[model samples]
Target chain A: MPFLDEVEAAIPALRRYAHALLRDRSAADDLVQDCLERALSRRILWRRQGDVKPWLFRILLNLCRDEHRRRAARPVLVPIDSVSEAGGSGGQEEFMNLREVHRAMGQLPEDQRAALLLVSLEGMSLGEAAQVLGIPDGTLASRLARARAALRRTTCRAPDRPDDVRGHRP
Target chain B: MTERKPIDDDLLVRLHHGTAAERAELEALAARDPDIRARLTDWQRQDAAIRALYGPVAEEPVPHRQLRLFDRPARRWPRVSRIAATIGLIALGAAGGWFAARLAQPPARGADLVAEALQTHATYSVEVAHPVEVPATDEAHMIRWLSKRLGHRIAPPDLRGFGFQLIGGRVVPSATGAAAVMMYEDDIGRRVTLFVTRESGQAETEFRYSGNGAARGFWWIEDGLGCAVVGDLPVDTLRAISVSAYHDLIDA
Candidate 1:
C-alpha cells in the first residue's frame, strides 16, 4: 500500500467527522481538504508504522480547534454575499424532527460535542478517542457524560415526566 | 461551567446497548420517574439518528481537488518501504486476528465496496423525489452521461420483464476512477441499484452474495468491470435480478 492510498482511504472517515464537527457540508469539505493537504505536505511527521486513521483524525480535530480560536478572536465575517449563489436551489426540506435535535447538538460545548461524536457516533473506544482529542481518558469520559446530559437537557424534557421524578435516576 | 447531577453512567451505557427486556425492566422501574425514561429514550434515539443522518456523508464523492494530491510530483522518500510493507502485513494480521474487536475500524478492501453501496442505498432510497441523477424517461442520455464520465461505454440492462424499470443512473466516485450506478424500481417504488466499476483484474467466480447493513446484493466481476445489484429485497429476489442483469451485460 502506497502512503498515498492509505491517506486517500481515510478521506471518507475524515470528511464524515469533519462534517459532523463543522455542521456545514462545504465547510467540512474545505476543512478535510485543508487537513489532508497539511498531512500530505508534511508526511515525514507521520511514523511509517502508525495507524493513519487516528493520526488523520488528530490533525482534523486540531484544525477544528484552530478554526474555533480564529473565529473567536476575530469578529467573523458572514459570507452573506455568497448566499445569492445558491439562493434559488430553495433547499430541500430537512426533517423538522431532526432539525430540533440538530439544533440541540449545535448548542453543545465544542469539547463535549467532539468527545460524544467520537465515542458514541464514530464507534471509537474511549482510549482511542482520547488520543484523537489529545485528552486524558478520564477527561474524555467526563466530557462524554456532560455532553449526553447537556444534550438531553432539552430533548428529554418530555411533557409526560412527573414533577417528583426529577430526583430519581432513569 | 455550571454543573448538574451526573446521570448514572452505567445506566446510560445499558440504555445505549441494553436488552429489550432490561430496558423494559428499567422503564418499569422508572415508571414513577418519566424523566429518566424520557432521558434514556432521547439519548438512544440521538445516538441512532446521528449516524443515520450523517453517515451518508462518507459516500459523497471526494472532491477532485483533494484527489489531485496524488497527481503531484513525488516527494523524496526515506527508503522506508520495507518497514511500511512489514507494518502493513502486521496490521492485516492484527485485523484478522481480532476482527470482532476491530470491526468498527474500517478495512481497506471489500468492506469499502459494500459499505459504499449500502450508504448509497440508504441515501437515495429515502428520497421522496429526485431520487436519481437522470430520470428513466431519458435512459439513453443517462447511460451516455455516465459512460462519458467513467471513460467506458456502458449500458443498463432493461429489466421490465422482471417488473423493474430503469429509474435513472448516476456517476459516483470509486477507488480507481468512477462507478456507474443505474437505479431501477418496481411499481410499488422499491429501488435496486446496479453498480459497475472497472476492475484491473479479469472476471471472478460467477457471482457471490454479501451484505452490509441493510443493503444486500450479488457482486461479480465480468469482463474487467465489477458489477453489483443492491437493494433491501430478500436475497433470492436480488439474486434473480442480478442474474438477469449479468446475462444482459454479457450479451452487450
Candidate 2:
C-alpha cells in the first residue's frame, strides 16, 4: 500500500486513542491532525518496511505529552456525572458506567493512564505498547498494574478492606 | 488443607494486556479461582466500557481536512507516479484474490445486512452538524459518487409524500463492500436512513423487519443489492416507506 493510504487507515484508530487520552473531541482531533501533518511532511524519512501504526502512535503520544505540559495550569475536562444516567439500561446495571470510569481515570498519574489506555483500550501488545511509550516492558507492566489497582480502588471501594490491597501480592 | 495461592494483581494486569496465548493461560487459571474470576470480569467490563465510550469515533467518517493532506502538492509527480504504479499492481493482485474468494464464499445472510444497516443508522443519525457527507443540493454528484463506489446505479428514493426530505448520503465501508447510506428528515427533525449495498449472487427476498423501540426498520435483497430502510416512525408508516423505497430502487 502507498504510505499515504496506510497513514489514512490509521487515522480512526489514532483519533479513538487520542479521544481516550485527552477526553476532548476537538482537542483530540487537533492533536491527531498535528501528528498526521508532521508524519506526512516527513514521509521521506520513514523506512517503508517499518510498521506505520506504532510510529504514528508514538508521534501522537509525544504530542499529547506536550499538550499536557502546555496546559498544566488549566483544569482538565471530566465527563459530567449526568452522562452516566443516559445509557446502560436493562441488564447492563452490573457494569460500571463510562462516566464513573472516566472520572476514575482522571485521578491516575499520566504514565499510568497512557500505559493502561494503549494496552487495554487500543489492544496493543505489551511489547508494542512499551515501544510506543519508550519504556521497558517491566516498567510498562507495573504501570498497568498500578493503573488497574487504582481504578478498582476508586470505582469499587470496600471500606472493610485495608488500604494495602493495592500493595498485596502472591 | 493445602495452602491456597493468593491472587496476584500483577497477573491480573498481565491478563488485561497479554497476547492471545498469554491471555488464554491466565483466563484458564481465572476459571478455577472465583476471586480472580471476579477481578478478571471487572477489568474486562472496564475495557468494554472504555471502548463503548470512545470506539464509535473510529468509525466516523474521516474529516475532509485530514483527508486533504494527502492531496496537497507537496510531493513531486515522479514519486507520486511510482507510488501510483505500485498501488495499481497491488490492486490487480487483490482483485484476482477477491474474485477467487467470491466463488467460494456464499453471499452474506439477511440478518448480517440488516444488522449492518441498523448500526450505520444508529451511528450517523445522531450527528447534528455533519450527518451527511454530501448535501442534497448536490444530488447529482452524490448519486454519481455513490454509484461508482457501490458498483451499482442508485438514486435516493423520494420520500416527500411521506413527509421526509432527502438530506444527503455517504458511502460507508461494509462487509460485502461499500454501502451507501442516505439520510432523510421530516420537518420536525426526526431522521431516517436508507442503507444500500451490493450483495452479489443473492436471490430476491421479501421485506424483513428488524430493531425495536424508537430505532427500527426493514431490509431485503433484490437484484443483487441488499437495502434497508430504517427510522423511528411507526411500524405501518415504516413499512409503507420501505415498500416505496424497494420499488424505487428496483425501477432505478
Candidate 3:
C-alpha cells in the first residue's frame, strides 16, 4: 500500500489510542493531529521502515510524551459535563458503567494505564504493545497485572456510587 | 479428587492477551473453575467498558485537519527547501554579530558543542522504541560502527559504577562534524548520555557547565574532541558521573 493510504487507514485506531491516552476529546484529537503532521513530514524516512501502524503509534507516543512535558507543571482537568458529551450511541446504563471504568482508569499511573489500554482496549499483542510502550515484555506484563488489580479494587468495590468516582465530590 | 488452584494473576493477564492457543487454554480452565471464570468475566467486563467508553472515537469521521494533510501537495522537497531557506536566513541574520565577536576573541566553541549534545540527548533519551541506531546488545558492532562514523576509536565510558549501563549509541550531526552519542540508563530507568565529536587542531579546554530543569551537564575539549555528559540528574550527581566519565574517556 502507498504510505499515505496506509497511514490513513490507521487513523481510526490512532484516534482511539490517543483518546484513551489523553482522556480529553479535543486534546486527544490535537495529539493525533500532531502525530499525523510529524508522520507526514517524515514520510521519506518512514518509507524504509516496516509496519506503518506501529511506527505511526510510536510517533503518537513520542508526541504524547512531548505534550506531557510541555504541560508538566499543569494538571490535566477533565470536567464532569464533558464526560457526558461523548454519549450519543451507547445505552445509558452501559455508558455509566463505562464512565465508572474510565474514572477508575484515570486513577491509574500513566505507564500501567497505557499498558492496559494497549493490550485490553486496543487488542494489540503483548509483543506489539511492549514495543509501542518501549518497555520489555516482563515490564509490560507486570504493569498489566498491577493495572487490572487496581481497576478491580476501584471499580468493583463500589458498584453503587457511580458519581462518587473521584471521591472529591461534595 | 484434588482441586486445581486458580491460575496466577500473571498467567491470567497473559491469557487475556495471549495467542489463540493460550486463550483457548484460558477458556478451558475457566469452564471448570468458578474462580477462574469469575476473574475472566471481570476482565472481559473491563474490556467491554473500555471499548464502550472510547470505541466510538474510532467510528467518528476522521477529522478534516488530518485528512487534509494528504490533500496537500505530496512533494516533500519544496517544504524541505523552504525550511532550509528560512534557516539560512536566520543564520545570515546571526552571522553579522557572531563574526564581529569572533574578531575580538576566539568563539567559545565548547558551548555550541554542549548545546548540540543537550539537543541530541533531549530528542532521543525519552525514546522507548528505537532509542539507538545500534543497541548495546551488539556492543562490539556498535563500537566499530560508531568509531568508523566518528573517525576515531571512541569507547563508551564504563558507567557501571554509577549504576548506569550502556544502552547503546547513535551517530548524530554536529556543528563541527558527526557526533557520537552513547546512552546509558540506571536501574530505575533514569538515563544519561555522553556526546563526543572529533575536532581537528582543537585545543583542550576545561569543563563548562550547562543545565535546564532536571537536565544538567558539562562539556569539554579533551584530546582534540568535544565531549559532553548530559542527564536529568542533580548537578552534584551529574558532576560525579561526568568526572568519572572524563577520566575514563578522555584521560585514558
TM-score of each model, in listed order: 0.46, 0.53, 0.56
Put down candidate 1 lDDT per residue, A48-155, tens digits, no spaces: 376788878887886777567557768664332121121112222232145545666778877777878887668787678877887776566556766776666655
Query: Against the unseen true structure, what C-alpha lDDT does each candidate score?
Result: 0.66, 0.74, 0.74
Is candidate 1 or 2 superior in DockQ? Answer: 2
Better of 2 and 3 by TM-score: 3
TM-score: model 3 vs. ground truth:
0.56
Sort by DockQ, best first.
3, 2, 1
Predicted chain A of candidate 3: TM-score: 0.81
DockQ of 1: 0.11
What tens digits encode model 3's per-residue C-alpha lDDT throughout B1-252?
113243556667677688899889889988987766766777777877777777778988998988988777445324344346345433433233234334434336866887788899899999999778899999999889888988777888889998999999999999888899999999999999899998767865545567655676767675467888999886556766876786567322
Model 3 alpha-carbon drift over 4 Å, by segment: A47-49, A73-81, A92-96, A157-170, B1-6, B73-252
lDDT, candidate 1, B1-252, per-residue tens = 212333454444443434577657666756765566666666667776566555667877889988887666244343356467445434533223235224433224444565566666777767868678888789889878988876667889878987898988877787757888889899988889888877655423334556655677666553456777789776556766877787567545
Q: On residues B42-132, what C-alpha lDDT tens digit does candidate 2 reach at each position? A: 7788777766666667877988888888776335323354357445434533234235334434235776887788888899999999999
Q: What lDDT would candidate 1 get against the real structure?
A: 0.66
Q: Spell out the clash pairs found in candidate 1.
A: none
Off by over 4 Å in 2: A73-93, A157-164, A168-170, B1-5, B73-252
Tell me how each candidate scores on DockQ against the true complex: 0.11, 0.18, 0.30
Q: lDDT at B59 for candidate 2?
A: 77
